[model samples]
Target: MQATKRPDFIDQQYDFAAYIRNPEHNAAPDGIETRRMAIYRDLFYNNIENFAASAFPVIRAITSDERWHAMIRDFMVKHHCKTPLFLEIAQELLDYLQNEREPQADDYPFLLELAHYEWVELALSISEESAIGEDVDPNGDLITGIPQLSPLAWPLSYHYPVHRIGPEQIPDGETETHLVVYRDRHDAVHFLEINAVTARLLQLIQQNVAASGRELLESIATEMNHPQPQQIVSVGAEILLDLRHRDLLTGIHNIPER
Candidate 1:
């Protein structure tokens, strides 16, 4: 007896979906008209392409139209995004650029970093975390109290000056770029470029939430082997105050009186 054959309908559905996703590589379903298939293909691809362009405006501006379209096509065809959410599609593109896509000579070396930098603002804007809480004291003493980094605040470091990259401002050499991206109380996302020391100070606060601002500064001063620890403490206090004012530090951690 001959083996049973699978129904053509199932195969046709798979073929049609594949063609819509990648017309260049896959053929149209056997019976479907080319014109109709083209409509589906264009619709699907255009939506994704438009979303990517909007999400990574800097990347789209810097790359040639030909290259940008090719990159989007590659992402559409190659990357199997896990999330069904539209917002997450941008993140999927970033993941593809960072881990899957091979670098091309014409592509900027900071392409992935810049894409990530752009995504950060969108991500922070949609984050569910509150900027400040009832437990936080906005006017707490920086020197005596534990400083709390806001959940919406992120300290990020990149090898390239991603924040400054644009069509005409491509950096020549790699430099350590330290940035703090935060959502303020007003629900606005802000980015601040800081030196390595300030970045480290934020990291210390993040790592040791129980440490008072003065203790954190003392630790930093010890690490730096500063000749005058008091001066470091003073400067560090000012830094803490600035961060607090910027809403990067939610406020001090309130401990009950003993």
Candidate 2:
């Protein structure tokens, strides 16, 4: 079947947008004045670059001016963004980095992970997700009761220590870095680095949501073949309390006593 032709107005709009997004590659539409087009070009590109700079401040700071602008230009030119909203621009950029970005010799090996870390901070700050639930008890026994992991708390493992990357130094080597990025009740975002053991414990809690905190700790001990499982339980209890204090654990799930 033959495809229907798009309206001339649609083609004109596409030409205008294409040139504005990547003026170096695409020419301005037939009759548009260069002076008028310059305003749109600067306005559109600057808006995107400013937002990208804000969303990924660490990336912006550590990256050279030419490299940073090149990256933003590539994003605008190549990545097909899905949303038109400004708040979602960070997420869109993340999508571009993860899936669409072409590899470059000058790009940091940890660029993707670093972008994700930055995006998570912005995402959690603006998130409207609620931790409030009728089935959660603020002061319930973490060990004896089923603990509710806060949706606001994210458990992430990266090959690089994304949190440590900044203007000071790029660092030397990569290792398995586990972190929990969370938004507390006060709406402040925090990045907490945890050991491998703590990471596994959180993983167990997320997977076995119905199990009591004691059961979760015991499972970890069993997995490790630790003879003194009670010690694990004791220490894990303290860790749970610490998480509660930090608002990472939304407290114990208020399942009715059988």
Write down the worst ten-residue block by lDDT for model 2: 249-258
- How far residue 198's Cα lies from its native spot in candidate 2, in Å, is 1.2
What TM-score do all the candidates reach, one by one?
0.92, 0.95
Backbone clash total, candidate 2: 0
lDDT of 1 by residue, 1-258 (tens): 999998989889989878877887888988778788888899898899999998899989988889999998888878999998889888999999998888998877788789999999989988998777667887889788888889999999999999988888989989999999999989999999999999999999888757788989999999999999999999888998899989999788765566
lDDT of each: 0.89, 0.91
TM-score of decoy 1: 0.92
Candidate 1 local distance difference test against the native: 0.89
Model 2 / residue 130 / CA error / Å = 0.5
Off by over 4 Å in 1: 1-9, 255-258
- The C-alpha RMSD in Å for every predicted model, in order, reads 2.4, 1.6
